[model samples]
Target: MKTSDRRTARRGAMEQAESGQAAPAMLWRYYAVAIMLVACFIVLVWRVIDLQVINHEFLRSQGDMRTVRVEPIQATRGKILDRNGEPLAVSAPVVTLWANPQEAQENDEGWRKLADLLGMQSDEMVKRLRRHKGKEFIYVQRQLSPETGRLAMDLKLQGLYAKREFKRYYPAGEVAAHIVGITDIDEKGQEGVELAFDQYLRGVNGSKKVLKDRRGYVIKDLSLLQDAQSGADLQLSIDLRLQYMAYRELKAAVEAHNAKSGSLVILDVRTGEVLAMVNQPSFNPNNRDSMNPSGLRNRAVTDLFEPGSTVKPLSIAAALKTGSFTTETRINTSPGFLRLNGQTIRDARDYGTLDLVSIITKSSNVGTSKVALKIGGEAVFETFYQAGFGQSSGIEFPGEAVGVLPNFTKWQPIRLATLSYGYGLSVTALQLAQSYMAIAADGVRRPVSLIRGGQQGVSPQQVMSPGISRHIREMLETVVLKGGTGTRAHVAEYRVAGKTGTTHKVGEHGYADDAYNAVFAGLAPVEKPRLAMAIVMNEPQGSEYYGGEVSAPVFARVVANALRLLNVAPDRAIPMVAGASGSDSKRNGG
Candidate 1:
């Protein structure tokens, strides 16, 4: 064998062995790649299963957390209606302009257009936009009218947006200001009836989670997060017609007499429903630009003053109820003065001898003091308490005052004597009106109601005997028909009965010099009493600041108009009387 041939054979054999190794390596590499691909496919399939089934809810929740949103659904406030179903206060649609200040600041044209539509200076708007650039949400303006809001939207200003809202509006303005009350910027009740019935007036706020588009617009409806409940409506007992009439008369009288302040309240004698309550210098609840503590005060329930001679009827009634005297009982009131417990009691003028009717009609301070002495302080105090003094009327208002009526056991001799004719104590106009209501309703005392549903199960209480109340009613009628104090309060078309009070203003030390509070309380249609009223004029400036001069005229006008407005048939055929010149000519100052 040749060496070349042997080498060639070995080389060929080596090449063959190398070829065999390369084929196996290539096949192994292919198999490994195939296994890796198959493993990756298996992992992908497992991940799909985990995400679509086992962890489906978790992924869905993450997606929702990133893209879903919830927003509040505001409910409308309840409506407030008068007794006649007239809308006194209502909610009207409004819009609020908001902005992403950072975005707005960068768009000068947009900012300028927005400023123009908002009635704001361009430079000022730019400054404000710059100031709030870091804030995510900023309110540019609120409570824009529908027209203005539409204009703003038309501008399509960058980052500027509008949200729909409801604003409370008072249609009657100041005419029913104190009665209807007012709401706050967030549509929440702030004062008056609004505050009193806030729970019923304020609706429940609901919410919803919705899917939105890229432009932040809500897409299809989603799940309801919460349900909204609308507020309940309120129907008050106030008669709008009577209220207007009373307000007009009270305003006129206040202007005529130059009174510092005045208040008038009318009540339904049978049901104790307050038909009209008015105070002068009232502010419009809608505007509220000129509102202050003084104008917002409800004097009918908040203010207190000495009742003076107006309290005489209560004393006389007490004496009569005790079987101490009758309408014809006589007492010696000559010299117009009497002394009891070392305190002297004096009348406006001397009346030597007068019967019970004459004594009450004349408003004799001396005669009333003598009668009170006979009735005793305990009885007088009890009578005043039973008439609803020294307590709230339970009306739904925030700052009602319980007027002072000192205990009889704590009264000194002078205090007792002064209290005989309405002094040394104080009472609100509402309290005085309630007293008259007691007489008009034949001795029953009903709780005053502001709401229309009759206040649960409460009923009137019999405070006095019917016989005594009738007798007192007759005596009070004589006061208006032929009396000394209530002559001007008599309405021509109605049989009226009332008492007058002209009390000196008390200072820190004692009574002020010459300053007086004139008050009058009365009822109309004495034959079948329907309404009772009380009026008070604080610090009336003029020579005729007596109750008969300053307050009675207002009372007569209010009663007359209220009766006509309420459609109460006139009980008497006499022409409507005015001033102090009537059948009764009592000059007692209340």
Candidate 2:
């Protein structure tokens, strides 16, 4: 066959193959692929619309749940200020560490590092985390410094967090601890004035929305839900100068005498404001990790004791009030002893005959009992009741005691005799001070005040006549003279009037034979009183346990400095009496 014929036949066959079913099949495959791509594009567009429009809010909310959070805004607590605007207690900024247990459970090594930083055993921290499993948040430690919180965050622990908070700080330390009181780690008041005024001192915390990173640290603040309101400042009537002076003297006396405890209270006679209130064996509010619970009491207002011979003047006042006796009234105490209802009352020695002034200066139990028997019980009870006995001191301090004063109707003959010399009844140091304060204010009883403006506009009750009060004041002056029981209580240049009291402390069995409470209560500047103070030394274990020996010296030292601090003028010009100097008998000084 010829080559040209074979080439023509082959070309014809190729043309037929291109124009046949193979061409249609290829075209159909291209059309099918284009249709499928269009369908996929339509479905993708519809899904985009659903996600961006219809489900937008739900999806965004889900995202927000992971990163956004509401946080508390810490409020600054109020400050407690002294009368002279000295800061007694304040709130300090601190950090509190917390953990998101769900995230924290993933990193054991990170948690061990946190445990070491927090001074906790790693195993204990693990146990705590296990106990709180599935919890979102848990506290690791509270009341840390900001530096520690920052260091903790630098660890990059997954769920560790830090919140701002406040802790209470006391500037006066143990000196004013009993008065200013203490607060817990959360800034809640636990004792003293802090407990009394907690509502006014604690602040209202606020809240805000914030955006946090994956590490549980705030990155941005979105909006504030509430604004924090700082607590109000509290102004107390306590004079820090006088408080320090009183505390120094009281603490020294408590230690020097080896006393179990001691309390000293100084009040303004005119305003009834507490100038100084101090207690021994006090705990430091700033550092309470090793605090003793026994030393936490404010003994001046909480503890009760018999006034002993300190109430002899009040008995004399009661007798004088009944008009049955005058400052010159005489009573026979020749035998120096009297038997009333099988109970014998005796004086320190035989005082053949005595005037009202002598009975008090001698602190004669027999003479006082005779006077009380003569006047009956009603007169004594009335004077005592009106003098704010057995009633709440208007200070309303927490744990303030209302001393026991039996009604006159319940007084027996022996009871009346014992009451004459401050027995068979109880009174707190504050109540005794208030009774003396009434005398200092010329028989006007004013409510005691702890706050600066606490007693404003309060009317003072006239408990005794002005003349009687003056007469009693003059009689009390002799008690501080050369032969008086309170002679040691006399200030160098200030004429003072006071009474010494020594009472047996009640024990678990009964009145303890050896344990005694030595007390000296007095007012200075006899002509016109300015300050009334009470000093009580509980269970002085030294040989000099008498009120004059143990408690009077304290009075002398405190009054000597306190009067000068208050700018009270000295009244040394007044002169009247001269008596032989001699040591008082066992019970003569009470």
Candidate 3:
């Protein structure tokens, strides 16, 4: 700092001044960095406060979206049981396979393996995968087998998932098809008893909230949702054994006669329970793919026809009820034909004279018309309506037809005469059976039922007088034993009473040229009647078209087997006819 000394002193002073200024500038930069660090810390604290308190619910909801889910809980449908509490229909578990199409398209081998396991073509499966690639969820197959479902999971088919569902299984198949009815793929009742009690049979569905892990497996039950209500069980009045017996006989008769269709129903005389109901050409509920509308029709209640000679019991009972005639009263049925209001009523044989009982026994149209004329239209119509004609039988099943019964005021003179013999008026097979039930039940008409233990809130209605019913029952007995038409319906060991009906099928124009509806209605053990039944065959195309030949045999065979199966004692001591003895009995009893 010498020569550089004098200058150095000033330079040093300058250098010290410059150093002081530089120090201040460097200090300012450091202080500025410290202020920036403090600002950043304040911003982070505000953000933490916003997340932990102010907007905490919104953030928490976002977190829950990944862990908790609301799932649908399917309710179980009701079980259908026979009278003996045997299960006719039950619900079975099934799995539905779904796919995430985008994921599926990425794994060709996985898709192929899934297709093979499901018994589907690989190319078709590929096309479906490609078509639904944009979709996040797609149904691959519904109602998959357990084995196939397991295989799909084992293969780890990309995007493949399974959901549990229920399917209805009918064990007895077509044997009880018409009675039990069937449900659709969605587990909803479609027809028959299933549809009738759908409200009770279909249970209430519920929902559940579940907590899940990242992998989508449920972790906690939460226990905060309503439980599903299972459907109520249905107990039908049908006896499985009796129904089978009736079905077999009716099916055989339909096949033997080459009939278009047929139906049969068995009713308890005292309780008014429908023990058996059968329809031919029925379809198995389990195999619905081949079912047709015709096969699904319940002919017993839906079909209506002219009741023919079967209407005689009602007419005769009416006459006896009003004191217009008696079992011993005789009428001149000479020439076996009578002309009334320009219409002719004829009989199978010319009986010059006959008593009240003989008229029903011979099934003479002329005799019946004469008796009906005595009772008059008002009385007959009232009796028929009271016997449950032109009205539903009140069975639970849907589509029960109320067969035609012309109004009393609308009856023409000729129409009145025709109605006496079950013509110009139509009645269902159920109505026909109920008419006879009144006679066997001693003038009481009970509502027909298909529910076991009897339906609640139903009571029997009085339709006729006890005295008239007893007399008519006696007259009907003569029709099955040593009488006309219904002789074939007589069971050898049990007293049976009934009438035969062979009516020409009515068409749009009028009665068909050759088509006929053969029908038979009867009660067994006339001394103490326990069961009443009716059988009807439509458009039978065999050697015989008469109710005696076509329908009565079916009634006899069914009644014989049903009674024997039920262990009902034989009211009369007589040898069993060939083929009429069931496997439970001997041709010659001990």
Candidate 4:
């Protein structure tokens, strides 16, 4: 065979074998590639369907959970202002430092550096952090100083946070503490005017959805859940200048007399606004590190006393009201004492025969007893009830004490006599001041107000005739005469009408022989009175314990200064001469 022919024949044999095996392998490869392409297409379609319809909301929610959160937006608390627009209780936005325990633990030095900025020891912070090991949130410090808060933010420590919040501050400090009261860490009012009008002072908190970082810091705001609303500002009736004057005088008198405590209230007779209400032994509301319950109380409205002779004018008003007696009516009290139903009521001495004005001028117990016997106990009780005794003054101040005024049916003969001269009953200093307001306002019982413009009307709720009120007021004027017990209460540039009260402190058993409550309630510039006030000194320990010696002086000093502050022109040309002779007695009686 030729070589070329043999090679060609072997190549043909090899080609035939290769072609037969290659056809089966190519078909298998085509089928396998097609199956894989179909599987990938089905998988891609399934993933798209699941993500678009079946689990869209779930995935979106999961993403949001890692980023967005709702955060509170703090609202500014309302400001409390005096009638003259002086700031009393004010709220300022402050920075509070907070932290996340877990995040802070991730950076151990973060808390240590924060401690230095917070004026805290690093070791102390370490213990606090360890104690809150499982806590996601903790307060590093609340209400930080501006400088301290700025420095803390500069550090940018891990897990550390700051939020804007309100903190209440009082500018008047202890001077107006009792009336302005105090607020808590969350800016909630806790006492005085703050508590009384808390709803108006505290604003609603708002919130918004935000995106936060891993360290729990807010980064992006999403949407507002609610809009923040600022609180309404409160305009109080208090006159800060007058308040300072009243506080100064009351504090002086209390200290001079060595009394346990004292209360003073100054009211605008025409408007029924409380110009000044002060108490001795007061607390600083700005910081209450060492507060006492007794001192925190608004004693003028909260504490009660027998009132003693201060109620005499009320008795006289009743006398004039019922037409039971005229101004000329005389009571024979020459014996200086009255023996009634096994009880003896004595004056300091015999006042002889006295007309209505003279009776008040002398504060004669015998004369008052005779008048009560004539008018009957019911008439006197009705007069007191109408004058706002045994009930609230409508100020609605928290913890206000409504004094005890027994019904006439419960009165014995002796009780009636004592009631006529301010015994067998109790009255708060504020209530007494309200009673005087009726007289000052010309028989109109004004609604007492702490809020500015709170007076709805200047009319009487319950009233005696104007003529009757005027007559009684005249009789009270005599009580401030030289012969009157409250003669020391006479102001230099203004005529004063007031009664002095010296009641034996009611002990657990009965009236104590030694202890006394010295009280004076009155209106200044007797004609067209501008201000009415009440002064009380409890358990005065000095040699002079009478209302004339203790409380009357306070009323005179406070009213005199307050009137000057108000720029009230002097009504009288001649000053009230001190120690001028009239009908004042040696030792005044209740």
Per-candidate local distance difference test: 0.82, 0.87, 0.81, 0.85
lDDT of 2 at 70: 93
Best model number under TM-score: 3
Error of 4 at 118 (Å): 2.2
Model 2 clashing-pair count: 0
lDDT of 1 by residue, 270-361 (tens): 78888888898798887767787789878888888988988888888888778868888898988987776776677767878898887877
Model 2 residue runs over 4 Å out of place are: 1-56, 105-116, 120-134, 573-582
Per-residue lDDT over 1-590 for candidate 4, one digit per residue giving the tens place of the 0 to 100 score: 99999999999999999999999999999999999999999999998899878979877898889988989988888899999899998887688998777767644686688888777998999888778879989998999877788888887777778887878999999999989899889888899988988998888889999998876777999999998887899999999999888898889888888999998888888788899999989998877788887789889999988998898988888888777699899989988888888878888887689998888887888888889888898899988998889988888799999999998998888999998898889888889999998888888788789988766755547568878877877878777766667777877688778888888997899888889998899997778888888888999996888888788878878888888888888777334446635334335543
Backbone collision tally, model 4: 3
Candidate 2, TM-score vs. the true structure?
A: 0.90
lDDT of model 2, residue 342: 89
- Per-model TM against the reference: 0.89, 0.90, 0.91, 0.90
Question: Model 4 Cα displacement at 11 (Å)?
Answer: 25
- Judged by lDDT against the true structure, how good is candidate 2? 0.87
Candidate 2: tens digits of C-alpha lDDT, residues 354-409: 99998888888888998999998989998888888889989979999999999889
